[model samples]
Target: MVKVLLLITSAVLIILSLLQSGKSEGFTGAFSGSKGLDLFSNSKERGAEKVISNLTLVTGVLYFALVIIAILGQ
Candidate 1:
């Protein structure tokens, strides 16, 4: 059923998002205006980080598609 797929996709999305490593410079860095988290940095994801990031992206896309499908089916 569409509802089942929706639930699974949403859960996966949440898990994938949480599994990803933080790119931010933590709470202190935010208020301190630290340059540690350079937005234009050349950092790249490798191995599991890359995999998790990709999975998150794919799951996010799937989540949106399922949402639209559910709404349209109503």
Candidate 2:
């Protein structure tokens, strides 16, 4: 039930985090002050990156909340 959901949420968070590009130059393939250009190419790619970052943050929060709930339930 709750535990299963929590596990799934955690897995999703992990995957999302992995899928996201890192802030460092090595990961993004461009150094700082490049104006957010690299593999992203254009505004659409940047927007998609933002969306994924937001979703990763949200899912991370959810995962933490679920862990607390599971602990408190015990």
For residues 1-74, write the lDDT of model 1, one tens digit per residue: 99999999988888899898889878788779886567887768999999998999999988899999999999
Q: Per-residue lDDT of 1-74 in model 2, one digit per residue for the tens?
A: 88999989989998998998755456354555654445545433468798898999899899999999999999
Against the reference, the lDDT scores of all candidates come to: 0.89, 0.80
Q: Candidate 1 has what TM-score? A: 0.85
Quick one: how many clashes does candidate 2 have? 0
- Model 1: runs farther than 4 Å from truth? 36-40
Which structure among the candidates has the greatest TM-score? Answer: 1
Pairs in steric clash, model 2: none
Look at candidate 1 and give me any clashing residue pairs. Answer: none
* TM-scores of all candidate predictions against the true structure: 0.85, 0.70
